[model samples]
Target: MTSSGTHTVDAVVVGAGHNGLVAANLLADAGWEVVVLEATGAPGGAVRSAEVTAPGYLSDLYSSFYPLGYASPVLRGLDLARYGLSWRHAPDVLAHLMPDGQAAVINRDPEVTAASLEAFAPGDGDRWLHAYADWQQVAEPMMTAITTPFPPVRGGLSLLRRLRTAGALRLARRLVVPVRKLGDELFDGAGGPTLLAGCALHTDLAPEEAGSGVYGWLLAMLGQQIGWPVPVGGAQQITDALVARLTARGGRISYHARVDRVLTARGRAMGARTVDGSLWRARRAVLADVPAPALYLDLVGAAVLPPRLVEDLAHFRWDGSTLKVDWALSAPVPWTNRAVATAGTVHLGADLDGLTGYAAALARSELPRDPFLLVGQMTTADPEHSPPGTESLWAYTHLPFRRDWRADEIAEHVTRMEQVLEDAAPGFRQLVVGRHVAGPADLERENPSLVGGALGGGTAAAYQQLFLRPIPGLGRADTPVDRLYLASASAHPGGGVHGAPGANAARAALARDRALTGAAYARLISTANRALYP
Candidate 1:
């Protein structure tokens, strides 16, 4: 089905990542003739699985858990279960292991999570429940606002309505407060604070950073509401479901077709040309599921982009690089605390102070002597991830981007990462029957979009968020070039397994193609772009 020569379609979706696939599905669903061009031989992009460590062991290459995927309305609406997408969860959602052998755990049951916190300190259990209650008041509007496009007309209005009843000022204050402060203000024990801080670390944000509270609170609340679930077989199942859904709807995907340039005419994106000289023409739009820099500078070229956009791209910041180590274990991780064994995900850092120190080191562009590790117990979450009685384990830690990551350096760092685990789980190294290490360079090589191994598209920092994502503009999927939409993690609402970026782009394309209002919508978007980028 990989057509070579010239072909015309309603839309040409560049990159068959989840976002591109999502965009293709939405467009195809609307009766558009959409074609997806993927550079890789297969789809899935970062959300993939493989037996890198050993046979019969499946490790999620990049992202593993999908609390966001479960919560995403876009993914949920697709009803992927019909396409063989089954979700699996661990006995407990997550555990934050401390050096002293005590752990803080979050379970789907509030009482269980609260009781776990209460064990560390009195009154924290009730406080956790209170926090969840507050979240419920605005959860609908908040999620809508986050998942929707910026300016979020409907979602913003709904949130405004909820604010009146949900303590407007207090809620607004909480949204911007640092996670460290929020944790201290809400709970008396380190358990609650540590748990929140651990969640915050899921992003590039440190606990002390402003707006970190929102990320932490959002993720913690989602974890409480919906456990961090993984696909039954592997991460590939999610992609397979998306692909299956797309193809079933008569969408076509051309693999090994790396889009070399977005073909533009005057000021409009008309199609895409692959590196191998194959041109896929688009009658309606060309949605790029690549990174912002890649989309603007490399694919479209700066000559055609607005001068301000080119300038803005220069100052764009990327999140920290990553070092991931996967292991095919002979047995489960022998944690010092038995409770940690039941959790699917584990956050390893000594304490709040240790986490702060680790973040500070990353901020300073230095490798931490004690890195904060986000470890996934794949087999604990889903049995299909590995052989019977054995564990498929992987842990990734962020590192400062470096020009060179030598083989010996990666090996040494692997040893250090294992040592950190050894401290919390005695004999953890002994269970490793085989292991695979992927540094920042290795990751970017596997997926070009993962620049410098920095995931989350770009930094999740406040400065680069909302209307400021990728670059300050309208924050819609629309690019300076007409009929082109940026439908990748680089768009608003940023990263995670959520398909909001792609969904938003699809909506924008559809809105611009409407019979009566299409012209007006296109004019309004183009006019706004001119006003901002001029």
Candidate 2:
């Protein structure tokens, strides 16, 4: 992929996902020459799109929602709108359906959302509103803390300053509390708790696991401020915008150029070598948007890693595997309730207990007879996603890794999911004109980073979180290798389309470069500041 043989750049980024693109764009903005290498023919790894079902129906292959994208300050800096990237949102964010044919809907207005919650219990509405008000105080701080360095000392100190001692402790406990328990402790009805647990499914974490409630609460609040918006055309627009920015700044991105090994000399990263014997020589650094195990075990070689880190990789637990089905229907889903059809995202689990049961099934490595589904009606968010009166939608659920999928097994899974929806919305399958099923195997074939279909980087368990993501004492984007960094979801803050990991890696690389450039520059700046100010 070297247009010029033996090419050189200030930095070489491996994997052209959103994270890698972010680092590449930022480096180029600083006037540093950068090159991005992608394994696939096109960019936007998981954040990709295709017309899988019908001719005119546009289906998002992996991700469909972008609440984090809308709320991200890092992405806000980009003029994505100028690059033909517009966002579309549903009038209502989501709904959690119940077995009793009742549903709790999340509306844009806090007052309206809270009032709706009162349908479950007389006083639940006020509690939901008040709890959300409390959540706002720490939402920014929590985002800051997780997205920053390992200890997140500065973000933590700022949060402490705002929450004080008692307030801080309470908030910490609230975030760590399991979603299933949180709802029971805080509300008297199934609506509020079901809503929170539905959010927990965004990750692989079970509703009963600690830190699961944080996602439910965090996503709900963000949905209030910003609906789960989607790119106007498709998720591909995001990749297009990032690639446009990178190329406009004189950076290069090479596709189908798979990196074979990270070239290191004298315990320092020099660059990388592709499988085709193409060597990309980096002058300043190399940043990788890959999983920890892949980076350490495959690319860098296990011989170079510390013994403890090698051991940590052994115990690394992946999130539950996923089974996704996309459909191009002749008409919108005939939700018997009629209300659930209005939301962009819909939780298809029967009730709160149904969600917890799905989680329980995962913990036991068994397929749930009643799988919890996260269904998306793209046309609900943007009519342009499909033809007039038709729908391009998808439904995703989790399966334990033990049940390795075969072609027949995948077909069975798809049928089960359709039946589940049909139970709630009769004649649902009658509307399907075309269908595409992505089992765990198909997902891995589409994106290797998904590795056995584990989404959300890795398991967001209590032990594997904070300073222990990927491995213990290795949460920072900077790796032990000099001039090398982990800029992927496997690093701190884990997965999501947020691009925080990439931003952190870019900042880390710049800081390391300044330090490596020599202490003379550092001392000169210190002395100059003193002379000018003091």
lDDT of each: 0.91, 0.84
Worst 10 residues of 2 by lDDT: 525-534
TM-score of 1: 0.98
Off by over 4 Å in 2: 1-5, 515-534
> TM-score, each model?
0.98, 0.95
Separate clash counts for every candidate:
0, 0
Off by over 4 Å in 1: none
Maximum-lDDT candidate: 1
Candidate 2 local lDDT, 118-151, one digit each (tens): 9999999999888878867777777777667677
Tens-place lDDT digits, model 1, residues 89-189: 99999999987879999999999999999988999999999999988888878888888898888877887787774577787798789999999999999
